[model samples]
Target chain A: MENSVDTLLPTLDDGIKCSAITSTDGLVLAHTGSGATLDEDFLGAMGAALFAFGSKSIANLVGGKMKDIVVEGEQGFVKVTILNDKLLMVTVAEPLKLES
Target chain B: MQQATTSISAVQIAHNIEKRRLFIEKPQSQAHVTNMKDAPIYKTRPAVLQRAQNQDRTPLLKGEPVKEVKIILAGNVGSGKSTAIRAISEIPVIGSDAKAIERNALHNKESTTVSIEYGMAYLDNSNLHIYSTPGQRRFDFMADVLCKGAHGMVVMIDNGCRDPLNEMDYYLHQHGRFLQNYPGIIAITHFDDNNTDTSLLDYSTYLLKHGLACPVVSLDARNTLEIKQVLMNLLLQIGDFKTGKKRA
Candidate 1:
């Protein structure tokens, strides 16, 4: 299966400028295609915090948990997706529609 | 009566504990003290045992960049593996040394650790998960399982045990392949009662002779302060290894 960290993140489409697989504790397990100017460790840590915030906020406001989070910046977007309770995948890529 | 400047530091506490251990180890006229060979294999001090019993609260480690440092404590039977874990663990250790009932048993002797001993020690934001490997060769299967993510190890050698040097060699031969990646320390226990003129230098020499290297220090299993010192040494070694500093 492709559930392992190395296989999971690198297999993502080429649109991802940077893809980091990290534990829920915010430690980077595996990372592929680093951002030109972004710090990988700091990105993983902040992505973990952002994911926690999104998870809790959705749980409180709506009635369920957050599927993923998409933050759009001037240059591009960052997506934090929870792979499992113990693992998560963070990807930085150019703007793209969710359905597309 | 107002005490502000006359407070005890951790170093002072450690010094006091060492002094007490030295006093207890002194050759006295007391019969029971001299005849400890017939006593049980493990004798944890009253204070250490009480501390182990009282340790039940979860240490606060949330919202921090914590490094999960797993350390495996391995040695022969009755080498005080479990005692070391309990002495340093901030939480109540998961396993207790029970009387053994099986022969062709773990150690070909009485009293074995049928399972692994689990403990945790927290240093600032770095959290260490300590596992005491069962001493019997029969339980060698548990080595890989226990050492899954061990950052380092502290091997306890009982000077009182028969041919402790051979036992030490056995451990080195068994785990040296994997343990070379990280730093380790040797804790020579029971030297007080065993009194074979064994020193930390003896262990260091053996390791050097075998081309294996690590720090060797005498340890009093009953002293929590001494156990903490061993842990501090390992943590410092880890820090040195991580920072690419020169290692002794």
Candidate 2:
């Protein structure tokens, strides 16, 4: 299962800094990163927590399961997506630097 | 983005409406402050008692062969949330405890719950699934996740802490929405560890002043009998909430 995150890494663009695949129970299965010093455990736990609550909230309010959650901050973005019922993927990426 | 905010705002509006309804319509029960130990659990509500007797107390999962009741145990680090579950659970607890990266330590404990802990106990006719959240504020998202569809909340506070009242206030505010709809109980731990001046009545009074008519009791989380008492009280409180009967 950890290979799932590694397999997806090659397909992502250059802006991606790190990525992790975590169980729904918040355990990190696999991770791959190059640009940032990522804490895989913390990332996995936070991602699972966010996805669980986000999915529930969306289901209650919008009448459907949430596919993903994208949180934008001043420094970067954290995106969490539900890969399946039992797993979720989290990615931390830098903003696209527009060549001005 | 506008649509998302609107949907969230609608939920907030509905929550506020429910709060207002309870506060205005149930003034006698909502405003009353009585000693929980002395008060009868269901003095006036026979329907709730009958329902419990029939094993129809609110189930976490509906249409299941076995009735599952979800309860969330929450508190600060070293407040004994995990220990309480261990004491009461019939099976081995599934814990996500890990070493703390931060230097700050409470109760000289090095490791803490990183995500969630789970335990299970079978009561007369119901299977109780107990879930505990990590105590750190950074892991608060786990608490929010566990709060969904929960039957009740047990907030264990360490009495020996420097500012137990402040900790109580923080937990109450953090789970205010859940408390508003479901029953909540404050279980004070570590009372013997320190001779704190704050009495149990003070906790009850604080809760009443803050518009929460929840029970406050002291117990050693490691003691199975004491933990059972707390859960029994919580079940009674859940019954009270369901029947709209306020504890007198």
TM-score each candidate.
0.50, 0.58
Can you tell me the DockQ of model 1? 0.02
lDDT of 2 by residue, B110-216 (tens): 66676678899765356789999988665777898889999999999988887778888888888877876787778888877755677665776676556666667
The DockQ value obtained for model 2 is 0.07
Write one digit per residue (lDDT tens) for candidate 2, span A4-85.
4578643456787788887664667778773346577778878866775676568767987788999998889999988887
In model 1, which regions exceed 4 Å deviation? A1-100, B1-64, B96-98, B102-111, B195-197, B245-248
- Residue B236 miss distance in model 1 (angstroms): 1.4
Give candidate 2's error at residue B161 in angstroms.
Answer: 1.0
Q: Give the C-alpha lDDT of model 1.
A: 0.66
What TM-score would candidate 1 get against the native?
A: 0.50
Q: What's model 2's lDDT at B215? A: 63
Name the top lDDT candidate: 2
